[model samples]
Target: MARNKFQTLTEQMFYILLALQSPCCGVDCMERVRQMTQGRITLGPGTLYTLLASFEEAGLIAQTALEGRRRIYAMTPAGREMLQGEYARLKAMTADYAAYYREEEKQ
Candidate 1:
């Protein structure tokens, strides 16, 4: 079967949406992702802006304001739903890993 668009999020995509949970501009969004991941993830301007545009186009995020050349964005209800789905998928993967490893250790 053909897969749906965004059925699974890339690491960059996931962090970008997570940062947009609150209204913020592109620069702030990059910083937020960096801080949240403890510098493990850093988004360059090119990747960040491109994903922001895509998300806005998909109706997953909405641009809340424009300040000079800066545009602020926040997650829409659709974005939240997407985020929740990804979170659940990730949680389930971890649970499966734990269960498999536990069984391996028992054997």
Candidate 2:
């Protein structure tokens, strides 16, 4: 059986979509991710471009502008819902882990 495409987003995909919350070109995406992650996440041009194409194809993101060779992307309604769902899932995971550790401490 095939897995769902949007089951989860990679770190790169998450940050890319996040950067797209505002209008920004490809180069701006790299900078934004760097600032947001404090240089922990480095986005290479190849990965960024590939993910952009895939996201656009999947209707997760739409091109809002084109400046020279750069394309500015933003989240679509679908993309926003996807992000929210992913955030919820992540939160649940952390909550569960924290609960387990708290229980362990009481023993």
Report the number of the highest-lDDT candidate: 1
For model 2, residues 51-102, the per-residue Cα lDDT tens digits are 8888888888899988888778988888888888888889999999999999
Q: Any runs in candidate 1 off by more than 4 Å, and if so which?
A: 1-3
The global C-alpha lDDT for each of the candidates, from Candidate 1 onward, is 0.91, 0.87
Estimate TM-scores for all models. 0.95, 0.94
Of candidate 1, the 10-residue stretch with the lowest lDDT total is 1-10
Error of 2 at 55 (Å): 0.3
Per residue, candidate 1 scores C-alpha lDDT tens digits across 1-107 of 10256789999999999999999999999999999999999899999988988888888899999999999999999999999999999999999999999999999
**What is the clash count of model 2?**
0
TM-score of 2: 0.94
